[model samples]
Target: MNKFLEQALLFDFYGELLTDHQKEIYEQFALEDLSLSEIAEMKGISRQGVHDLVKRCQKTLEGYEMKLHLVEKFLSVKEKVSKIDDTLAEWECEKNDPEEMVKRIRKIADAIIEEL
Candidate 1:
């Protein structure tokens, strides 16, 4: 994964655990694509302070992912769904019995739902 995409996924999974100030700064830096100096100027803090806060937020989000594994599980499920879609596409081209494909897809979908 790209570094920024990984950070965005981590934030999406665990952002609610952050303080509002942390969330705002992180969103500005990560989602809004603000430079550290830009965020510092907007937030009325020194550039180093903004940098430190962003680093802290990344560490906190990574710690939560390490403990909870929600991001890992989500990626796994996403991969499985992609596989299911690929299977369906293959089945369409091969003109195979749809029953088996449907059953396999359902099983994968059910497992994903269970993980959630």
Candidate 2:
């Protein structure tokens, strides 16, 4: 996965676990895509301070991902579901053995939903 997407998933998975201050800064910097300087100007902090806050928040989020693997599991299931959808779409137009493909896709989709 792309770095930004990975960070975003991790952030969403872990942001709620952060302190209020940490959540504020993280939401601005990661979720809202604010520049460090921009956030610092709004928060009355130095750019370096804002940078450090973001870095700390990143580390915290990554720690959660490392220990819990919630984001990783969610992403894996999502990918599986997408692949299943693709297979189902292909099976719709397939000329031979479409039932097996459809069954496989249904099973994957069911498993993904169960995980969710």
Candidate 3:
């Protein structure tokens, strides 16, 4: 995944755990695409301070992910659902293989259950 996208996902899953001040700075730098200098100017802090805060927020979010794994589980479940959708779409076009479709779907569903 892209670094930016990875950061965004981490923030999405664990951002609520952050303090209000950290959330505001992180949202500006990570989600709002603000530069460190810009965020520093807006918050009346030094550019390096904004930089440090953003780094700290990323580390904090990563720590939460390491402990909780919510983001990992969510992505796994989402992938499984997508596979099920694709199988159904394929089955719709290849109507001759109902048995195969059922087998594939059941296997995917079982994996999803295991994940949960």
Runs in model 3 with CA error above 4 Å? none
Which pairs clash in model 2?
A: none
The lDDT values for all models are: 0.93, 0.86, 0.93
Model 3 has a clash total of 0
How would the candidate models be sorted by TM-score, starting from the highest?
A: 3, 1, 2
Q: Which parts of model 2 are misplaced by more than 4 Å?
A: 106-116
Tell me how candidate 3 scores on lDDT: 0.93
TM-score, cand. 1:
0.88
TM-score of each: 0.88, 0.85, 0.95
What's the lDDT for residue 7 in model 3?
Answer: 92
Better of 2 and 3 by lDDT: 3
Q: Give the distance in Å from residue 106's predicted Cα in candidate 2 to where it truly belongs.
A: 5.4
Quick one: best TM-score, which candidate?
3
> Per-residue lDDT for 1-116 in model 1, tens only?
99999999998889999999999999999988999999999889999999999999999999999899989998998998898999889998998888988998999889888988
Ranking of all predicted structures according to lDDT, beginning with the best and ending with the worst: 3, 1, 2
